[model samples]
Target: MENTKRKIIIVGGGITGLSAAFYTKKYFDERQIPIELTVIEKSPSFGGKIRTLLREDFIIERGPESFLARKMPIMTLVKELGLEDELTATNPQARTNYIVHKGKLHKMPPGLMLGIPTQLTPFMKTGLISPLGKIRAAMDLWLPKKKGMEDESLGHFIQRRLGKEVLDRITEPLLGGIYAGDTHSLSLQATFPHFSAMEKTHRSLIVGMLANKQKPAPSIAGLPEIAQKSMFLTFRNGMTTLVDRLLKELQTEHLITEQGVQTIVQEDGGYTVHLDNGQQIQADGLIMALPTQQTAKLLPNRSSIQWLERINYVSVANIALAFDEKEFTYPLDGSGFVIPRKEGRLLTACTWSSSKWLHTAPKGKVLLRCYVGRGGAEEWVQLSDEQLITAVLQELKEIMGIEAQPIFHEVTRLERSMPQYPVKHVEELRKVRADLAIHSPGVYLCGAGYEGVGIPDCIQQGKVAAEQLAAYLEL
Candidate 1:
């Protein structure tokens, strides 16, 4: 009789892959099923985009700074890993955010449900919009519901309901900043499905937003100011703490870093993962915790993944500058500010890291990080590091008048890393999944490509993939 014990290999050693390995081991261990697991990562390190650096007295995040606390996956995982005590929420006092309009920093109006003004008084008072623009946006209260279930571009939906100025000014910077993609091509259903549901349920986004805002929000003790607000939490040490803890749960020997997967040849009852290192790893089941394009390369049917290759990505650079607290002429109020595309600035957004998170910087020092690049602004990131810093500093001088040179600076570029979910992205992914189901049953895809780009989303994807593959192996 054949051995019942099964072997599984997970491609990629990032958060998604790590979580998949952890859960896969946990699932089979709980069921008392003999299983062997290996995780392959081409990069030298794990965590994919979750790199952190401790320089001087600052905790500089080369990638994502935090995960949404309300997402539940990361939060739950933290508790499970016994790191619950290390969790830290965003500063409650850092509630305000700014948007640069007409080359001036304007305070974002309160009561905004993702840039759609919900409160009448603040919306009318905000200087971010012109008199006519405000009037045009007010028309959303009276406009009929958009009549279609078809996937529509986010730009068209926002402009149709709120008007062009609102789209360019508030919605573009706020929503477009999230995906770092052209709103004209971004999918509304794939990005912000809640807005679509709002139109269907309330007939008007403004009404829906107001109704939702009035509903009692979730709260946390001792952080009443931001208790009901969207909470983004991170570790006291940095985002890397999560990755380091995950490694503890997974055996070090099972993880192979700095090794690339050259090919995946499917065979009867199993699959073979060939590494660039002249080694072939065989497995009964495979989990591809990689980007859609990378996964396309390993499959036999390239035609099915034509859409995957076409899924666009944008590059962005994170520039972290450390400055003495006294260097700032003006008070660094609020968390930070975002620049509208109309402003034509190198910086898409800037986060006052020190203010947003208390542990990010030591006392008497500040760490400010800015993102420089988006879809149309891709050329900016290609600039030399010095050139990019100069441009960022110039913008800072003009906007905040900070003249003192940074004590230290770090620039990290993520080339074509952020996936752009264009119109019909969800439908295209559905077809990809269906095709894979027919052609490759043991293979699974997840990460920033399909469901979401956030850390929590990736974690959830990894866990779900493990559960699905475990059942497939009948473990």
Candidate 2:
């Protein structure tokens, strides 16, 4: 008798699931294994939070604008899929960012890596910190190392090392903008392992950063040379391009859209997935690539479910506005600004989209995107589109002295979009994986909920999960 082909099912057709399907097909094709792959997505289209809006030669990104080039997996996949040329770097002039301090926008001093100021001269000259604050922040060099087995919050770590001014004025707004999380609840060990290692090794975060800066950086393939200069990046077209290319390359038979998975049951030696529309499919291996809350709804009750409940999520609203270039009094030079919660601002952060990426707007137009409703700011999510636009514009006018009405406006409200990596996040993930090994055998998990949240991080996680699942099935 001829051997039957093994079947693989991937739930949630986001970047992670799509990447898994693509790699699974490639792996089986290389091995000459008879394997059937199926991808189920809840939405009518794929690219779950990633959507590109093209209107009147203006490319608007409703989701993430870009991925950091330093991360290798996404760029490598881009090259493999023949999209190397479409990649565009941010404008060199827009590299610098600003922070709101005492009702004014102040340039974030250069030589600072994610709130840890490395260069002393720039750190001392910045008005974001007071003389006392500067003294407190510099005391990190002399402060003894903190020894504790318990996980520390980002707030505690920065305040201990760099003082409250650094945390409130700089670190809070920058990190809070990115994570949509309160620094007090964010875990230092899980979210940023490098910083954790720095403390463990050099006893001072600043000292470790300066020491590491002197050493040569590692080589990252397929990434653009410009990405090596910074920690973040995005495409000129939008993040959806990456997803669209992946879907295009993978065989259509292996991909499924508009199919919502309802439940999973163990069968013979594999598993059977039941769809919401009363359809069933069996697979030898399965991967659930979704947020923790979404994953919990599909799994059986266990310790992992409890951990999922413990892992909370926050909502955010991104408002994109377009205005004429002549409307602003201040020159639009820097990347944008982040508003500290202490400043009591309506918006969290704003990005100068047109300035950040060339060709994002026509020669005479300006584009900006504001982030709102992070952590305790859930009320912003419930605001009407007009209300959201008004709030963001009002804040921009107050902060940047721009009072022009937007020529075009786009609002995207994400209810529980960003996952909170609270203290003990790593421990929780380890337990979740262990539970999967016992209950949902031959299953994998990936996405922002598990690892890093950046586009590069998610791409790397997706690729890693794909390789692991393919190897498990011998495909």
Candidate 3:
């Protein structure tokens, strides 16, 4: 009898796709099932937004710099790939995070559980807010829970519970910096569901957070030493270390870069994936780890994922500059500072890379990464490289009073990369899932577009999608 091998194709060889392929292959290999797996990537490389630019004694991360250490998926993947020793934690002593207010950097109040102050003493002593602003924020303790099951904007939720000062000075910069989104339009439930849950359960967010903090830390059976370090972490070389490891593990034939999927047509037993290079791939199952827009193009039923077309992506740029330690007029003490949108500055945030991660800069020199280009402010990418650098330098001089020029500089622009989850985004995703189930059963979707955007979340999505596909195919 001729052997029958189940074929699987994963589109978009990003971290998500790599993860899906890894898990899927693991499942089939253990069962002694014959399988042919292929991963297609449109870009010249496999990592997608995970790009690292290494120069003379400096590691510049063009994309995400780190992942949350507390998250299990990325940690688990790292260990499985035997890259555990390479992992490094953020500088624990440099724990201070700042927000720019009135052209000055203010240390975030201690005991803050994601912008909500759990301790009263630090909250009261903090100068980030005015006297009236502090009084309004204190009102959160007595304010009744917001009524309604409907989703609301993060801006409205924060302003309602903690006051406008808290929203603008604390929550807006902190949360907006992560999403590169507008707080007034971003979804509370989708972005910070924990805050929403705390409000629903305890009525007062401050009280709820305090109560939660009092509880014991969650336990994991065999977490490594790296897992117990700081909140955010990365490898000594940069985040691309994980990507490089994943790429190395995949077979050359299994990994096909620079091949974009033009269209996917549903056949009797499976689907035919047409490539941009005039090649076609037939597979029993397909995993789409591409962005919302790219994945939408390959779907056979366009109307089913028409809502995906509405998924808006925000462009972001990172400018990494290196300087001698003595070049700065003032001390670069803290981890970094986030510029509030209210500050009306060209730079959104700046990370003291040298202070945050020792490996990022050479000895006796300082390195900083300035973030630019939020949702509506994407025009910064259009500026000439020199023009962009000049604008950033002007802002840095004004904010940090540093007049000296940088020793080295690099610019990276990620166009339409960050996805914005607006209010009612969960409901919209729910409908999209239902439509996919009806119109495209054997097809699967995962990545920043659907569930979550964090590295850990994307890994979890890939794992879940693989398990579901494996079960459906009875492998």
For candidate 1, give the lDDT: 0.87
Least well predicted 10-residue stretch by lDDT in candidate 3: 298-307
- Candidate 3 lDDT over 166-225, as tens digits, reads 998888888877889888888888899888999999999998998899999887766777
- Taken over the whole model, the C-alpha lDDT of each candidate is 0.87, 0.82, 0.86
RMSD of 1: 2.2
Worst lDDT 10-window in candidate 1: 219-228
TM-score of each candidate structure, all chains considered together = 0.96, 0.96, 0.97
Off by over 4 Å in 1: 1-3, 218-230
Write one digit per residue (lDDT tens) for candidate 2, span 354-403. 88887788888888888887787787766789988887778787888887
The TM-score measured for candidate 3 stands at 0.97
Identify the superior model by TM-score, candidate 1 or candidate 3.
3
lDDT of 1 by residue, 66-109 (tens): 87777767766776788877777788898899999877889998
Candidate 3: regions farther than 4 A off: 1-3, 302-304
RMSD score of candidate 3 (Å): 1.6
Shift of residue 80 alpha carbon in model 1, Å: 1.1
| Global Cα lDDT for candidate 2 | 0.82
- Candidates 1 and 2 compared by lDDT, better number: 1
Give the Å error, residue 432, model 2.
1.4
